[model samples]
Target: MPIRARGARHRTGPLRSPGFLRSLVFAAVAALAAVLPAPVGAQAAARPTESRPIYSYESAVREAVWVDTGLDADGDGRGDRVAVDIVRPREPAQQGRKVPVIMDASPYYSCCGRGNESQLKTYDAKGDVVQMPLFYDNYFVPRGYAFVGVDLAGTNRSDGCVDVGGRSDVLSAKAVIDWLNGRARAYTSRTGTERATAGWTNGRTGMIGKSWDGTIANGVAATGVEGLKTIVPISSISSWYDYYFAKGAPLYDGGPAELADAVESPDAQAHCAAARQKLVDGSPRSGDWTQLWNDRDYVLRADHVKASVFVVHGMQDLNVRTKNFGQWWDALAANGVERKIWLSQTGHVDPFDYRRDAWVPVLHQWFDHYLLGYDNGIERRPMADIERHPDQWSTDRVWPPSGTSAATVHPVNGPVPGVGALSASPAPAGTASTFTDNPALDESSWAANIDKSTPDKAGFATAPLTKDLRVSGSSRVSVTVTPTTSSAHLSAVLVDVGPDTIRNYAGEGEGILTGTDRTCWGVSTAGDSSCYLTTSADKADVGFTVFSRGWADLGNYASDRKGVPLTPGKAYTITLDLAATDHVVPAGHRLALIVAGTDNGLIDPPPSRPTLTLDLARSGARVPFVGGAGAFARATSGARPNVAAGVPDGTPSSPGIPVPRMAAQRLPGGAGR
Candidate 1:
């Protein structure tokens, strides 16, 4: 019953009992534990494995370092220093194992917070990060990865002026990536002379975030930073010009300067005043193309992107607008960058809140494959995951689906005298419709009673569809108009004219309903909880919905760079690109198009009001159909004369879309998230 040691004399007395053998084994384990690094938090220090956790979450190391950017945005005479808070597995670095970095460089860490809970980073007396705001650090650190939360220049703990997506904002994050790859310098303290290096990293990095944070990811990727392996930009901007203007039409009165002022910290405001003024002087409200806009336009530099891109956006996000992701996605495709995309129907909402069940694992696989060099084959899978309805998602081998093609539809005279019919064939020669420009009425006002004639807008509708028709991508309107004034503003909207239950974006919740119940994503600590409020779809029943919309300045019809007033009453042709969309017009539902002027809250109006006469024979819309023209033709084989009859009288309310980056401006001076 007693265990005997090799070559040792047979044990006598108490050593012969089984309890004594057990005591000896227990004592040996205790001796080994004392000599080795104490087992992490009540359990043995986890060892790296092909699958499962490799380290202890409780023992992850937390530290702060200030990365020095070469730019002097605040005119402080010294290069800007961006505060980078890092969380990594302590055992890996101690064991001489290097891990990849998952970074989120943002201007919102202290200003607006992050995620549904509106969490801010918490630190201890030593100024080391004790708790991070989001689940990135909690979920990935134990899995053999490092998470870095960076405060962009001029925000939070960083020292510089907020450039609002300009060079300073972009390069501040780039400097961190450069430091990881040994190309830039960092210090343990903000003003410390001593240098620090990222000896724990493998020199591979991935940047990710939502809104302004995500926009920084796009800007940094455009610089072609070598160590950045990929980026996941959600509801982000590709061009700051597009953020404030659309086709030579200003979307808002405030430009980059206002946004900069909104996010700059109180202590930094005086230092940032000159930088903010530069933003105002460089970005003219006249919508002229300038070097300033070129510096913030990432789409122009898509070819410079070597990092793989994972794009996520809401189709109904009027704040950032769908065009931002659409143009950026197209540019990335043209450059042959490895990419994936997720498109949702919600307005300005993050996928984590809407599709957390699926988003987390997909994101994990993406990072593991791209950042950690895992052979997970995520790149070989389908490229798109599209949310067609609330809680309903579908995957496609390619975005816009494979068979998408343009199908031309024109407006012709309907049975109702003034109401126009959208037909597959062009209208009769010499036919024309006229409407006066009204700056007061927006797309919502014109969307109502679309089957009836209105003085301010021209409405055209298709007959009740005999079969389901889907518009897969962006739509275009090429119209030849003769205006009564020298300059005019133009707007186009594609509407799904049918009763349906959709996300209640018009409500306070925007598109999702947050509940009292909470769900946890990762490990939790006293200062930070990985748990967050649960969310469900908030539905609203509506008679009709505006699925796609676009705006342009008639004076800038010839070029987006400059506006040249047209001769009154002379015909000029211009093509307007509708926002990219993927929507299904169900069988028995009608598809309608509305043409108007000055979409109120969306873009600034021109000084003159124009009554434009449209040449119907030369005016038509090119809609992206899933199966091209033939399928569209088959869906509407016979044109019904009165397409507008029997449609719902009630109109949908304005979808309460949030202002872009408004959440990030949650502080005293901020406005958008």
Candidate 2:
């Protein structure tokens, strides 16, 4: 057996015997040959009979590795080791050809898994990922790239307590990139007694994922790590504060402790109770920004990001909300990060499920151009992909499509919640509109009664448009209000008060549910399932759809961190903004603004209803008009729109798109986009 040639293999021995490792070295040489271009005019049979390849997708090396984050969250004294399971080409491992990495570091690996199909990792006898969740590993690993699945510290097999988005959560994966570039240390085992290294890597890497996984990508990229080249964060949060609160309104009933418990190790809660308690105490239920939230906010330090970014978010995503994407998009743009974007109408769904056929190839090209140094020309392509309808995608040169313009409109009060009109000019001086806060009613339900007298809310709008009016981007609201009570919370909504069949977003279930609906996305193994229930939305008649919304606590209006209660009957000026939008108010539809109390359905209900009076003469809403030529100027100037009763659609129209982009359509300072 010792007299063997370079390519010879021992017929009988341990799988990784000395003969096998040496033969693998030869196989690595053959893998290197796989990437080299063929020589010119040489006889095919006479080519160096290459034994090792430069790269081979199907025959790559697959194994598990541990990265030491250099932190001990549980105080056992050992470095909190992060588990980085890898699928790489063997040739790259043998020093044949170095490969860049595609990483999806997540806490979901052990708890729930990833993607719509919810695929989790499976292990062989040695504990390698036999079934990597979703399609990223299977599709990209075979294309001369290494796919790394990391178990965030404190979850799965990683050693540490889940610190949420704190140092442990963020720095754990940063250590992996550091190790790839030789800046940090890794070990062969969780015990840290043995050594391990990433000698096969090129030190360049890209991170991509959705929700918490994508949030990790954003958090890591914000650290300004040198080896991180790019990131693709889909439906992700740039600020954890935005996830749970708006202005001074808590979006959820429970505090961050519940969230920590939801994503962390079930048994490890006792160890991380202090960290979890910090979240509870910091999020004071009254909805104000705290140091804990600031630490978790990636947007604040986005200026430090050197990674090119790609963002994908759904407009109807109440879970993460479009604001997460909006604020982060603005910051990334302001910081001049190289970027691309995709805006969808789905609710908390991934693009792979919504745009299956086009997403994979586009993603493949994106990686090839950024990570592999390929001249794939993806940079020259359109920067935005927007959904005009479900599955009806259109590519645009820039988002907000160029030529968007903003116009200010004043509210003319009427008797009820949805009855008033929006005037081109300011309301009469000294005129004021009053309404009481009602915690029991939802926004759409409150808007449903245009004719009913309501003491709880006031609505104002413009007459039906003669032609389609496209409203894009966030709208700013400037108002001065006098409250009857010491404290009050204000909510504003921009409604398309037209007779059209809009999406059913009034309830918790934002999408249509299809019965007996079942479909498979990717290949499945014993350890993972790939099929999911098909969903469909059932459209209903509505007076109008609440396209954009905003919230503000009168007490917290002056400062997000500090609250100043109002003196009864003393008016205070507060300027807030509604959520961003890409909606089209059809011809003969009115653009209405509804000023109410807390959004009871989504946020915590206020203690009591406060009768509030708004100074209508000084209050108005600013809208981004992107309809066509002169639409913005006219809407702001002298356009006389007809205020007419809308006709119910004879047939159900496409679910009124609940959401949408950037460039030639960009407004001032990338607004509207």
Using TM-score, give the best candidate's number.
Answer: 1
The digit string of per-residue lDDT tens for model 2 on 1-673 reads 0111121111111134576567656655444444665566643433332222123444556788888898888777667888898887675456556778999988787677676545677788987777777766555654557889988887888888776676778999899999999998887777757878888888899999887778889999999999999999987878888777777766666655665676676545657776667777887877777788889899999999999998998777766777888888878889989898888766666776666556766777778778876555576788888765545566767666688767787887553333566776788888887888887766765566533457778777665566677887777888889999888888888877666654454333344434465544333334433445555553455556777788778887688766766788888878766777788777666667888887666566666568999889989888877844367434434335432433222211323332231001111001100
Model 2 accuracy (lDDT, Cα)? 0.70
Residue runs of model 2 more than 4 Å from their true location after superposition: 1-59, 91-95, 414-418, 501-509, 512-543, 627-630, 633-673
Which ten-residue region of model 1 has the weakest summed lDDT?
1-10
lDDT for 384 (candidate 1): 87
lDDT score, candidate 1, position 339:
97
Which residue pairs collide, candidate 1? 661-672, 661-673, 662-671, 662-672, 662-673, 663-672, 663-673, 664-673, 665-670
Evaluate all candidate structures by whole-model CA lDDT and list the values in order: 0.79, 0.70
- Number of the predicted model whose lDDT against the real structure is largest: 1
Residue 297's lDDT in candidate 1 = 93
